[model samples]
Target: MSNAIDFISAYNTIDSRLRAIYRGKGNLQFSDLVRRCAEFNNTVRKYEDDLLLCARLRNVIVHESKKDRIIAEPCDDLTRLIGHVAELLSMPPRLSVLREKNVTGIDAEATLAEALVRIAQTNYSNLPVYRKDRMIGILNNRRVVRVVGQALERGEDVDVFLQTPCSQILQAEDMNRFYRVLGRSDTVQEAIDAFEDNRKLLAVVVTESGDAGDRIVNLLTSADIPMLIRILEE
Candidate 1:
């Protein structure tokens, strides 16, 4: 009912969740748990200072109090802040907020010229390339630039190269390092982690089951990182 009670309840919830996260490990201190989880959990890392301070405040509220006597009460704002942190840790915001309707996919065999025209017309810098209904790679400006730069260096007919197939150009693009697959159910935090973990990642394709072969339901590019971060911080 009181701010102190509300604060303690949310703090306990966060504590329990942290223990569950590292279940089977030896009993650990709350500060230690927060520190260790921060290494892998972006939410924890983002609010590390606040959580640690709350832990200390929690000790004073409980340990320093006498029977039937409250020593200190947390402010209403602090109570609500902890409550929000608990809710986020329990159920993070999913990628649905970033979902794009009518995602366009390009045929792998489409010529570079056609792809460029589509890119220019649609204003979509990244387009998934598919062959036989299976996604092979993405067509992005960086890939096009690289191909054109190489053509000019060799004095090869740039027009001839523009006639090359999207699939052909994809072969020279580093497929393994440029993209990742995530399920539609994945949270925004996971998407942020995917981009953070791979500096070279160009895009994240979301599908029904996180398989590259599945039809893409949503796509996230580096351009969306700032927006995602804002969502989390907000």
Candidate 2:
């Protein structure tokens, strides 16, 4: 197919997907759609200028034409760029793209010392703590340090605190604020946005159905931010 045809096809795909996000809001102009979607969608925001330029170029290609003659065609490079943007906006890579395996979790009944040992062994700063196979909260090093510091302030027996169950630590976790849950359908861009939106986010839990009650399919820490950005860029 001609570059004009290919570019138009990709542009339509992006238009359709953006409109779907705001269904029942009445028909929106193409430029308006890009501007509004950019407010929440990282992919759109990243390619906002390119997409707007494509919109202008599309007008030139479609309107400045005579009967049975094409006026302009998008260059091959621009065509591919818009096509890539369309794919990302429409169906972005999921958490599975990370191919995370053997995601470690500690039992809530386990001692802080045991949890520390597991953290050391796995070299993961954020460890999911579970009760009855359901994830309750993350036992990250920050929380551990805070709890220990408070113990020292009170001059309590440090060893006794180390022996305390992880469940005690989980009690202080405000799961709704400090952590997020994303399901299988969630995209990698969404995960990136989640971290970008919340600086205090301890971890992002990926489950089969995006519920806290569901077993974790994967876990994301801030340390994974660089890799996540690389995945999106590539």
What tens digits encode model 2's per-residue C-alpha lDDT throughout 104-218?
A: 9999999999999999999988788888998878888878889889999999999999999998987544677788999977888779889889998878888988997797888
Candidate 1 overall lDDT versus native: 0.86
Span of 10 residues, lowest total lDDT, candidate 1? 171-180
Q: TM-score, each model? A: 0.78, 0.82
lDDT of 2 at 172: 46
Which lDDT value does model 1 have at 224?
A: 81
Where does model 1 exceed 4 Å of error? 1-6, 16-28, 32-42, 66-75, 148-157
> For residues 74-129, could you state the per-residue lDDT of candidate 1 as single tens digits?
99888999999999888888876665657787899999999999999999888889
Clashing pairs in 1: none
> What's model 2's overall lDDT?
0.85
